[model samples]
Target: MSATELAGTAPAEANRIGAIETRGIEPVPADERTGGPRQLFWVWFAANISILGLPLGATLVALRGMNIWQALLVAALGSFGSFALVGLISVAGKWGGAPSMTLSRAVFGPRGNHGPTVVSWLSRVGWETVNTTTAAYALLALISIIFGVGANSVLTVISLLVFVALTLVVSGLGHATLVWIQQWATYLFGALNILVGAFLITKVNWDAVAHAPAAPVSVVVAGIGVIAAGTGIGWANAGADMARYQHRHVPGRRIVAAASVGAGVPLFLLIGLGGLLSAGDGSLASASDPVSAIQVMLPSWMAVPYLLAAFGGLLLSNNLSVYSAGLTMITLGVRARRVVAVGLDIVLTLAGGIYFMLIAGDFYGPFITFISLLAVPITAWVAVFLADMLFRRHYDPRGLMDTGATSVYWYRGGFRWSAVLPWVAGIVVGLLFTTASTSATDVWFSGPLADSWMGSNGLGWVVAFVVAGGLYLLFGATTARRLGGTSSPDPTTRPGARTDGEPAAVRP
Candidate 1:
């Protein structure tokens, strides 16, 4: 039986609402790839419309010491530029019809792909945890406003459960459902967000915002890197996860444009709003619970509606993360249904949300630390993957799924040294310039070059990208062209068999 048969749905019925998507890491058959670039626009737009961007903008002004104009510029460049890379990489999904990490097996080999896959999975889970905690806080604050009940340990636990359950309901239904929800939800919450934003504008101290001091050009450059790492770099790994459902013939530029514009517009506005809000009151950047912190600026009636919108926006983001994490888990060789994988990921997210909300006590410190540390490996993986895409126009779908010695990607005991070595070298070099700190006074880890401009500005991820991508292009381009040619027959016709016709022993 074909992979789609195993998924228990006809091509027509595959992505319908209320259907639980049982497909694992299998490359989506061409018939099932029906969506256009517009779908991608909605997917990315809904995913980023959350209130989280506000805190990011506030961080720019309060922590990075950028004025409002500088913050807006940084927001535009960082969010659009980073997601443009995301859009570029998403083109691979249209070619392979597989999840991002699954397509990565073509470059990294099956066994060697595990390291980056693990990091990608962890990043997804971490983001889900953060979203869950934030949503739960919004719920608690809403309850406190409605019922006159303050947050307690019990309320915290209950709130977390509520948010997690809501996420599971949408994510567990899978792709068609998520796509549908993302579109309609974007319309509803996007309008509500605009309404709330209009109210927020009245609260901004325009005089304070206008008079804010401009920082040095060096600070602005550093600010751009920080915002990029926090916003789009964190999302770089999951670019192809959603695009897997897009039609193979969809123009790559359209894909890129969809993702970049869909995400960038809202992020630019929200982050700028955050900078504006922070100019009047800098507390949002430092608050232990940001949902509660922002409430002080709004009236009681607007507060309830705003918090509800926040909760819904967070749900939108969390469900997407959970869905993608489920796919990543399957790509990591988990032997279970996709919904089962989603449940497992959510359990970890729940634990993390509990600990962070009840135990950690400090939010921004740990969040900044998390973004700084993980950005290196994810960026390194992204670099190698994008560089591989330069010469490798087609993915041998059978080779992507085949783990046996017969697979073309079974290079050198299932490790593509050319790609793997560059990836590792990138991470190592990136870390040499990385310094992670939980607080101003507390340093978690500092590399040899931590005091240098790149280190201080958090450009280690950029260095990693350049090192890994440049090295791959220099050393691996010739081999990739010879191996990853488009001469093979289409994948749909011969599902699991090798398309290259060469004997397995002669692959390398």
Candidate 2:
């Protein structure tokens, strides 16, 4: 078969597209693998150190009545657990040099993996739309304030196209350029945000923070859930996408530490900043836009740089989302080239951004809904992936990436009931328990469980990981070693199977 014929939306080998990102889902050849734990950290930081997490923190204060300190604690709690998983998934990247979701084929059958890939794709698109809309709005606001241009349909459309074009171009250029941009952009944002944080510190009213009516304990718990769900669970699916480029022998500890610290710090600090802002002077509470709201406290010179950072952060956020979306586009069984898959993703981002901005009466309502909705299945999938890595120790990126029907991942006509069933169950649990009240809409799709107890703190995603992990362990204990057990290879095992962690002493 031709190399092109063997790939799923494969990019041509040895053919450099905009910059050097020649590899697709195929295992990264040892000679081509580059970077280390620090790169993963910065990659995650660049993607995260944005104005996005501020709103999540603000929601805790504005809607849940959380104090700044309380919000900080909960935000830390959120970022702490989520980024740790990012670390774990980064380890998976060392073992399997493929796109993050492609590893789902190792858990689910190639065909069955489609279900999770679809979820990943939907989530990336949703996030891309959100990032694009916010960035475009920032640009429109900049032009209006700096250039005296008024906001209008034409300007909005132009700004959206501009952001879409920039992000798409960067993503289309592929990984090398994306990583370089993230490394530098994160440094810029980190420095600027520190200055803004210091300025905000001077203006903070300690009385407001200390005297703000303490939220109910239940409300506090729910607030933790909101912050954690929005910030942590949302990033679960994309963990390995960044780390897969590392050398396999690089210590997993470094990978996990770097990524966890990189992601966790911004989320903790910035969300705390938002809660602090919302608690005092009511600037966060009163401002129309999340990114620029805090700028009201800064001098013109400071605000300009802060605003630019906001724009950069948005582009970085959308750039990563689009890259992931491209990976997912290929997983949908398309045989077209990688660039074609990315183009399809760009089209979706544009269409979705325009629709939400123009037609969706309340974008934040659906945005929050989108995040909460995906948390469960994503958490569940992560649990299974981690469990497989820890106990059932084998991976086959070559098999998963194969386009031929003969691939070992084509189990039971490409469906793994063990993985799919639990994922659906977790989704049901999420639907039953997820609830959060937003200004635009109260009770954005909650079920009896949430109303009966826990308010909007829906801990279903936690339960999902526990439940799905336990079930997969059960399935693996009985089914085969290849499914995450410690036993001799079975029909599922191929000659080239990468058995990184299997030890007979721990065999099931």
Candidate 3:
């Protein structure tokens, strides 16, 4: 259907807007965007590989005692879970030509949006810190190998500084530069992983791999599925940012087509390879750097390539986190130009690196365990949003003021009781569940019957998502507004809405 038809507008009106935006028919014109299937395909492919592929591989080595094969399967499934939100964002982008946060106003209301928006911003910050530190450590390891300064503190410091400098420089280039970085990193990491995989496969004792104390194949498969589900989770949240570029030009199917080819296929290959290799090596429980396994597996002559490839692969992964972090800051109204945001990011990155250097002792498991645990609440938020978008027709945000209860807080008068009560309930329930799950891991499950039922971070997310989404639905449809929602237009989208008077994709 045509844009006007989809939006429930008349043909004449749609034609007029199309002419204005695509041609020179109207005053205050916008530039016509170029590219269709190919650009989108490359962007999606580059994004997936750089953002999730290698990191998921590395993470699998560290978590779940996954051999390469098992790790890849789990990580791939995790990616599926993550992409659930991406599917919805793609539709919103095609229909509204708005960024994800802007579209969020419809559900949260203008002022009420601070909840999710702030969470996104802060979450990205933490991710950035983690990425920067990890990349620096990887690079430092490579430098140590080359210079014969194995485990030198000074080298580590120097690598940390370099990461800070590079991230800040790239931040000034804004989205376009970041996109370029992702593409370049994707190619680089792909080459590296291939080399690593080849070396490791050659070195493997097939008999040892076959005999490793095998978890039930089904358990391993299910674990692989779990990891895979979480792999592309961030892509869903960030899809609108990328899709905004496409929606202006390409058709919807083309966009979805690009996502499937670009993200889905390559990711499966990379993570699956990593998992298989990890499964073959029974040392997954203690392995932090999956690439290191290949190092031993490879001949001495191959060591240089393996080390360089490892550094490049980790660096590429870090670039995604930095880019995403910067974008999240922009959405949060960081008030600085792209360069300024980069500068702040550099400072944060260095601080994080230093913190890691000081705090990292003999154990890595505790840190990842903590991060995974803390990530539950955020994942819960994603799950709830995904549920509403997929199952309910009433939650559509294509047109009208999408800001439901959030609108009441930001633009309209009066508190949205529906949101407040549900939010509180979700938070309390989420906290209780997280605590219970942590205790359960320590073998402490004694609690009230209901509390016992709520154990596990995964379960906590389920509770929070259901409660929050249910509340939003109730408030949006029933009560004061009735099922139709308040017809009164939201002020956020009004001509009076705030703007920095700058384009969305501005460079520094």
Best by TM-score: 1
Superior by TM-score: candidate 1 or candidate 2: 1
Over 1-508, each residue of candidate 2 has an lDDT whose tens digit, in order, gives 4333434332434423346455556666555567698888777888887888877777778767787777888898888767888788878877777777887776776777887888888888889988987787678777877988988878888888999899878788777778888888777777877766777777767788889877777777777767777875787788887777788779989988887788888888878877877775554643445655666677776776677778888888888888878877777776555666777888888888787666666556667777777787788888777877764344654566654455555555656676777676766765676665445346556667776554346676766777788877777666664545443222234334433322112111
lDDT of 3 by residue, 69-142 (tens): 55545555555544544655665555444445544544444454456656665555555565555556567656
Q: Write down the TM-score for model 1.
A: 0.94
Inter-residue clash pairs, candidate 2: 112-414, 392-484
Candidate 3's TM-score reads 0.72
Instruction: TM-score winner between 2 and 3, please give it.
Output: 2
- TM-scores of all predicted structures: 0.94, 0.89, 0.72
What is the lDDT for 245 in model 1?
87
Arrange candidates by TM-score, descending: 1, 2, 3
lDDT of 1 by residue, 1-508 (tens): 4332333333457568888776677778888899899999999999999999999999989888889999999999999998998898889988888889989988888889999999999999988988988898889998898999999999999999999998998899888999999999988889889999999999898998989999899999988888889888888888898898899889999999999999899999999999999995789988777887788889999998799889988899898899989989988877667898899998999999999989997876788788999999999999999987876667776677776566677777888878899999999999999999987789998999988999988999889999999888766645535656432222222335456622243343
Candidate 1 clashing pairs?
A: none
Residue 251 C-alpha lDDT in model 3: 64
